[model samples]
Target: MALAFEGKVAAITGGASGIGLATGRALLEGGATVVLVDRDKAALDRLTAELGKNCLAQVTDLLDAESCDAMVPEILERTGRIDILHCNAGSYIGGDLSETNPATIDRMLNLNVNAVMKNVHAVIPHMTERGSGDILVTCSVAGHSAIPWEPVYSASKWAMTSFVQIMRRQMLPHGVRVGQVSPGPVASALLADWPEENLRKAKEAGALLDPSEVADAAIFALSRPRNVTIRDMVVLPSTFDI
Candidate 1:
């Protein structure tokens, strides 16, 4: 049977690369009108060109609440309605708490946690008014398992996972569905600067999960019948323990 996403409208943060880019492409292929939000203007432009008119790119720093507020209205004006929101913009700075600077911690919180919350808050009222919507957040497996080297990143993701759980409970009555995807490792720019040795080790350890796999899972969750809600999904390489 054909997928049910045809004619839907979606907004995705961090749509310039990695899992976000993969998810956006999947949505577009499924016949959804997609809006790509990212801070990287060049990458956004390239993606917009590649995805064509069905995909609109909005360049904005999601770290700032005001910018996020502006983006919501622009998307509404363009799409007329938003059926799905994929909170996929995030960053990973690896270090122990003692070695991590306050600025780094702040940036992690702002980009990974606060920004997702702000976007959800901004779009939720409209969803509530419509009495139906779906929200999918790109949390990480780190949220479920601790990583000593990336404590702050894990903490932020854990917070996001918690928020999704709470929001799912609260929004269910309003016909809103909230879910999270926790991906293991993806072959994306997020690993672009990793030490060659570490990269090799991760690969050898079989910890790499494809971004397309995660995107497929997101599409699956969002495509579930309205009566079926997927609360949380974990997508990881079979070789990894966590």
Candidate 2:
């Protein structure tokens, strides 16, 4: 059977590593042209080299509106049309509600929530004009079930989940599909910064999920027929709960 993404064009934020990188690879293998955006120039360059000519790497800081605006036009110039968008950039900060500093919370919300909204806003006009597009956001299990020590992180993810849900309904009539994937404890470099104690606790609880697992889920969601929309999906290790 042929891949569903053949001849499609996709734009992915944070596409240099982890789940984002995995998803980009899946899209390319399925015959889609991919625009990979990330903050790390070196990583983007490396990935672009690996993915070859069909992939375009743009060094972008999604936290800034100016950067996102500039990115969409460049993508349009290159690909002409965007068939799918994967808003997958995010960061995790662990702290109790009382210990969370205002600055830390601001940074988390700006990148996790505001950046996703800005990218969506910048891209929607073009998608709506075409009257068809698919949006897949990388939310987290924290959105559905709060993690006690990671209060701010949970809040940011919850906001992303809510935004995707609301947009799915509003965009449906415009011939656009909006969906979200929530992954639990994925094995990525994001875990590198976790405190040793927390890392141990997570491991004791269970093994971390593989990034490819979530990537596969994303591909599945985007490949569904136009009339079939997956509003939300949760991916977790078999041992994970809540």
Candidate 3:
């Protein structure tokens, strides 16, 4: 049986929009307290309020190690507990490696790779101490396959894929479950960065998914019975093949 959400506290990074936002909405429906962490102050605040009393918002730029590290501690203090964490904040950079800027590489790595590691590191001690918790990272199908169009993006997710595997093994003994939700071409703001022609092509081909569908996969992983760990829920539109 899937776990119930009552009284659980979930902190979602990048919770202001896209898959993160969709997950927050679903969790709230299940009666969990949702804390949305995002650097976009306006969107964070607006969505937090719109989500009503069960939701909390924190403005954090995960690129800043200090700000990123401070998130869990502060949230734990306020909420009194953090039962779940969804590391969903990330940026995308596509095209050939030669066409991508070195600075862009650093920025994407800082947010996608470094920040995610730091966030997991910060929360591990607490979750381990409690001997119970759930951590899920938002990953991509690109992490599993080498896509020619987005080398850097692929590299970052591949790094996270490895991290999730190692962390799951380590956290298991402590009773915390670590997993990731991998989705292919979700209909989210992330798609806005794609070339117009490519975006249109994906849509016409029915290769794009709604964020809610991705959110449903995430909820599925989190909702599994504690005795069972749904480590990797790789969701894809039937027509999306890279």
Candidate 4:
């Protein structure tokens, strides 16, 4: 079977583990060369070893503007072109707004909001110059609705969702596609940061998605024909009610 991403180059941030790593594997199986970017050097090395030669690991802190700016250029220097940019790097700070300290808040916004925008800003020109590309984001279901447990996290996702909507239109004329996968309750490290009670509830209810499921959504969006765009897909566990 022919895969849509065969011969393409995909750059996925947070690609060391969880949803990002799963997505990288899918892309590799489909014959795409992958560049895996994450902050953990040890994990990046392990993932690169696991994924083999076709996969490259880049240890970077997306919060660093200069580092973010250098990502696409470095990839292009190695691969000659970047066909897909999956903005999947983000953090979840769960708790009441009042409980989130100033540093935590800053870290959350820098990675979740600023880094995404900066990466997009770096890649759009390259994509547009070539007159085609795909930019997919790993959003959350919380972006579509209010999540009472994590107000600031919800705000960050809402911001990203809005960015995808507006950027899709902006890139339409350039033949670039912008889309997002909004997954609900994925059983990943993101959940590890949540309040103990919230995590317990999610686990007990069995309302959790596998990281591979989110990868499936990403591959679907990237595989679409140039004329078609799978703008927003919300993947939730069967038992997920809200």
- Candidates in order have lDDT scores of 0.88, 0.87, 0.91, 0.91
Cα lDDT tens digits, model 4, 1-242, are: 25667889999999998999999999999989999999899998888888899899877789887788888888888898899999999999888899879999999989998999889998998999999999999999999999988999999999999999999999999999999999999998888778898778888999899999999999988987789999999999988888
Selected candidate, larger TM-score, 2 vs 3:
3
lDDT of 1 by residue, 161-237 (tens): 89999999999999999999999878887776445776788899977988889999999999988999988999988
Among all windows of 10 consecutive residues in model 3, the one with the lowest summed lDDT is 1-10
Candidate 3 overall Cα lDDT vs. reference? 0.91
The ten-residue window of minimal lDDT in model 2 covers 190-199
For 76-132, candidate 3 gives per-residue lDDT tens digits of 989988899999999998777888798989999998889999999999999999999
Pull out the clashing pairs in model 3. none
**Residue-level lDDT for 133 in candidate 4:** 96
Q: Which residue ranges in model 4 land beyond 4 Å of their true spot?
A: none
Which regions in candidate 2 have their CA more than 4 angstroms from the true location? Answer: 193-195
Q: Is 2 or 4 the stronger prediction by TM-score?
A: 4
**Tens-place lDDT digits, model 2, residues 78-194:** 889999989999988875667657887788788899889888988899999999999999999899988886878888999988899999988988999999999988888877656
CA shift at 160, candidate 1, in angstroms? 0.8
- The weakest ten consecutive residues by lDDT in model 1 span 190-199
